[model samples]
Target: MADLSINFAGIKAPNPFWLASAPPTDKAYNVIRAFEAGWGGVVWKTLGEDPAPVNVSSRYSAHYGKNREVMGFNNIELITDRSLEINLREITQVKKDWPDRAMIVSMMYPCEEESWAKVLPLVEATGADAIELNFGCPHGMPERGMGAAVGQVPEYVEMVTRWCKKYCSLPVIVKLTPNITDVRLPARAALNGGADAVSLINTINSITSLDLDNMVARPIVGGRSTHGGYCGSAVKPIALNMVAEIARDPATHGLPISGIGGISNWRDAAEFIALGSGSVQVCTAAMLHGFRIVEQMKDGLSRWMDEKGYASIEDFRGKAVANTTDWKYLDMNYQVIAQIDQDKCIQCGRCYIACEDTSHQSISQLIADNGARKYEVIKEECVGCNLCEITCPVEHCITMVPQASDKPYMNWTQDPRNPRAVAA
Candidate 1:
């Protein structure tokens, strides 16, 4: 197997897969089991200061599919409920006992610099590999001036990050909130504050649905409730886009990224790495499947790397970034005309109905060699929009063929947002 190890901003992990800061990393027991199961590291669950806050029961609920597969995980749980002294002791013992694994302390305190400042020295005393500022928790702590609320404002992001950088000698990783409009602002804020790397995304705020029987939304809070952070495979695409935005942005370019959200297997891990993530993080998947799942991820990634002739994680990182671009940079001059495979068509006019009502009226229905409804494309009328192709549910029924220099792409070129082809 090829090497799966990664050196993330001077913190090395045996592999790019690390358990995110969640239930999976809540304590030394769980973390050690995860390490034994092959996870390269663990970001300990977010810990708060002394006088630990009490948490409500039923603080988490999951969204699932027909087969009861969890598509998303929602939680109103706040930072660690364990007292600060006990958490610190455990962190110290865990690090001293297991020196090879990356043990990062996830921390959140009041927004004030003093609140964060007081916690830094205690955390560093644990000999932790790094510190992840827990700025992404979306549910219970916003009003306290922590979590997503602070994360959304770039100023707070910079302010708090600076606080950590000043007081902590270990590398500081700013865990970003996905609740913002544009991801770069917080990323830039972290970088501006001298963060060594950034890990994303914290969680997306979401309201799953209501529990009508209780006359409230779930998971019930004091007999009522509000939205919580949504996570798992459902959020993967959004997470990938945010990660890519940060990875490719010149303002934050070359920043070490810890890709989080919806990573279930090696394929998901590889995709994040290819998009320029130095390491990948997972929580929901491990919560559902347990730490043993990491064995599959490590084995699969190693085998695939050997097959692809990639000797290390760095070998293929950002390999796909060049192919991603803004809409205007797309090859609009290149076009595709719809084509139908006669043998593959099951005489379904679903394509014709779709084209006539919703798309370019290009395909004309006619009875061909056999007494079957055959659809032929009128090339001149074909706009290469791929609507017919998309409408056809049957595989290989409709195909789009490239048109060379047939027409100037004019659909979006006329928009005010199109700067390149403006009135020239």
Candidate 2:
């Protein structure tokens, strides 16, 4: 079997799939059950100072697809509502029992040297493998000058990370918020503060949808709602780009990453790993599908690794980072044409309508030799936009095939079409 084990910043785990610091890992009960279900690690729910914040009755909202499947999920839920002492006790015992599994504590505190100084040791006393600075909860916590409030400011992220480093002996992994304009700034700040690794992206601030009937946002409690953190499969593209940005940035290069965001399966986990995440974390997937979801992630990743001839996670980690680049560097002279297979077409006309009305008129509606309605690509008019390919309903029915380039290599800097071309 391919080795799924990862030693991220000295925190060892049987595999890279860990439960993110969410409700799924809130208490010993949930954490224990997750471990039994085969999750390699758990970043215990964000534990703040005593007197945890109260939660609203309806703390969640969701965006659904046509089939009523959740496309994205939003939550106004706060951190651990249990007492600090209770959390500490449970963490200590759980670590002792599951010594093989990685247990990292996620913490948030008031923006004070004393506040951080007070909590670091108490959490450290639990013998937890590591500590994650939870500066990325985007909702209720930010209002109190914690969570994303602390994360949005680079200086504060560096300062707080420094406090943890000074007061605690374990490795510090800074959990970052995605609400910032430039994610690299906070990532660089964490590195500057001597953080061992970084986990992202916390959550994006979003109001999923509003109830037209009541004219209120979703998860309305007593006729009110506030913007909550949005997450799930919809955020994967955003998260992937952010992770790739941090991974490829010169300043934070080689910095350990624990990727989190819309990671519902092994392929998602692999993509994060390929983009340079040392480990992957999960929350929404588990919350929706239960802890049992980790089983498929583990099995699928391991099987994929075996097929790819990768002996271990490290073998293919960061492999895709090299291929990620700015648009200016892309091959401008390259071209491809869309090919539609008539046999696979169900005569939906989705591609034809989409290409005709909105996109390039590359697809033409016509009759095939079999006397059936058909859609054909107008190769002359096709710009290789792939819009029709994406709009098509049948899988693989429309494909973009590379055509021989008749033009020599030329870029925007050299092209006559450029408004401001440099003197050759």
lDDT of 1 by residue, 267-367 (tens): 99999999989999999988888889989999999999999999999999988888777776575567778999887887779889888888778889897
Clashing pairs in 2: none
What TM value does model 1 have?
0.89
Tell me each candidate's TM-score. Answer: 0.89, 0.97
Candidate 1 backbone collisions, by pair: none
lDDT of 2 by residue, 103-143 (tens): 99999998899998888889999999999999899999999
RMSD of each: 3.2, 1.6
